[model samples]
Target: MSNKATLIRIAEAAGVSISTVDRVVNSRGGVSPDTEAKVLEWATRLNLDRRLFRSHLRTLRVAVMMQSPHNPFFEALRDAFSDLNLTMADLRITSFVHYIDVNDFAGTSRKIEQVAAGYDGLIVTCPNDPKISEALRRVSRKIPIVTLVTDLPDSGRIAYVGSNNRQTGRVAGELMGRFLGGEGGDILLVLGLQRMAGHEEREMGFRSVLRERFPSCRIVAALESGENRERAGQVVLDALREYPGIRGIYNVSAGNSAIVQAIGSLGLTHKIVLITHELTEARRQMLLDGALDAVIDQNPRLEAQRALEVLGRNFQRGESGTTGGEYTPFQIFIRENCPTISY
Candidate 1:
């Protein structure tokens, strides 16, 4: 058998054809730089003794698309990816973070198409809009895509790595109800984006729990803040003015700062039971100061790690198929148990 034939294990391990491996091993220069690098890495690991070039290794570029830094959660998520990039040199993976305006569907879709052309893989957190999904599906045809913090089930993405938002919302509902001590007053919901599937799922779960377990509590209104602090604060303030009986509050997305400010502005800081998502520094401080009652945190760092793992696995396997969703665990934090470390 030819020496190249014996390299089948390496080819399989690297998710490439034996002929491709042969070309990379012989330095014939037919494969893409990344393909060559992957093949060479596997060949080196296998100790193949034909012709190996260590200098052909190439860094794999990964694109991460998320919301603007106005939201602390996305900012933390961007930082998580940045930190991973520093340490992922061994894997030849580098991640670039990009923020997109979730409200502009056409612009966001175009951005994905343009940015995806230069990257080997994509990890994104966008609304569940048809345009965005179609963009993702089109991009998935060329490279692997992983949905972060939300699921785009029909987007042809490889996997979703984030928290079960529905369960998260349900937890918030129960906490709000219990915190209200069964007095049962109208509750106000401040959501980030109405198009975000995670936010909607959270709303569903919250409503379900309230309907089944806490019948006395009712949702007065669900206002979309678009993750804008000023808008969040104004809508919250208006809701308070309109619904004088609103005694409980839950924010399914960002704008927690605005929520706190609005509540405090109205002198209802200690009078209302409030729960918000994510354990940002601001939110943590609010919890400590008795401004926020509790926080349901979906750790962005963990999600980043998991999404990278999924991409790494897909690259090594050299194939893509729906692997279903990977649900990261969520944490509920109260003043007494909130962590002191910044995430």
Candidate 2:
């Protein structure tokens, strides 16, 4: 039989798709040893050309596991990935989208465990709990894993693709400190969700920088807004009422619109330098309208491109070195350099 015919026959006998057979032949991802042995035995029995077989066996599959598709930032990322053109003969990219409540550890963990069996590589936003970390570790035994946006410090993930959250925090803190014109006034730290590792790191970095550089500015209180605009607005309103001297605000997560509304309600426009992350549509408008002073943006396009490149490299060479367990730089954005939003 011809080489392709032999491969197809072996794949049929193994009860797996041709792509799975290709993966086994190339050692790109995980396949059962029995399946691998069967394919190898068939190749030997058929005396298929080793060089020809290796040359023709080229296909890679990767899974991208993320949070809600409803979020514009993640939606942008998804669109970016779909737009990638890794036009190579041996590479086939497939993305699997999963939506889990960012705050639900158990639910996320269950989903991870469920999907861990089928994928060759994983790109995921790490949940802020040990259970999810443990689940990732369990899966890494079989396939390479990469963390996206957020990180799991203890998980044996191969690389991370996201911003240097601490630096982002420090940048926000510096902007707030300078814009507030000193450390004597009160500032509120608003977070979208404390369970997100990205938010947690940003908060830490912001607080660390503020404490060291601007000790006079007290962080009056922090409240979680759960990424809800209404909740965020309400939280800021409550904080404003509770701490009447609030002069500045640092948002380490989403829900910036609500914060802006609360500030406008109090008529603090241009009076306080507001700093946040992710230059979404509302944030860009607010900055343009002079309601927001600065924003720390992690380039979603670059992040998405890097993610696809990492996966592509892994599929091509079975390895990647993008993440070295150090803080990656978070891009700083103001009204001046914010990239124009397409949709």
Candidate 1 Cα errors over 4 Å, as ranges: 1-56
Per residue, candidate 2 scores C-alpha lDDT tens digits across 109-138 of: 888878867777787885678899999888
Q: Among all windows of ten consecutive residues in candidate 2, which has the lowest summed lDDT?
A: 84-93
**Candidate 1, 173: how far from true, in Å?**
1.0
The residue pairs that clash in candidate 2, if any, are 164-328, 183-216, 183-217
Query: How does residue 62 of candidate 1 score in lDDT?
Result: 94
Against the reference, the lDDT scores of all candidates come to 0.87, 0.74
Over 1-343, each residue of candidate 1 has an lDDT whose tens digit, in order, gives 4575557877899999988877876777779988876877676566555234434546689999998877888888888899988776555578999889999989999999999999999999999999999999999999999999988888999999999999999999999889987779899998989799999999999999999999999998999998788898899999999998999989887777778888888888899898988898888888999998999998888899899988877775465698999999999999999999857
**Which number leads on lDDT?**
1
Model 2, runs deviating above 4 Å: 1-55, 85-91, 320-329, 337-343
lDDT score for candidate 1 against the true structure? 0.87
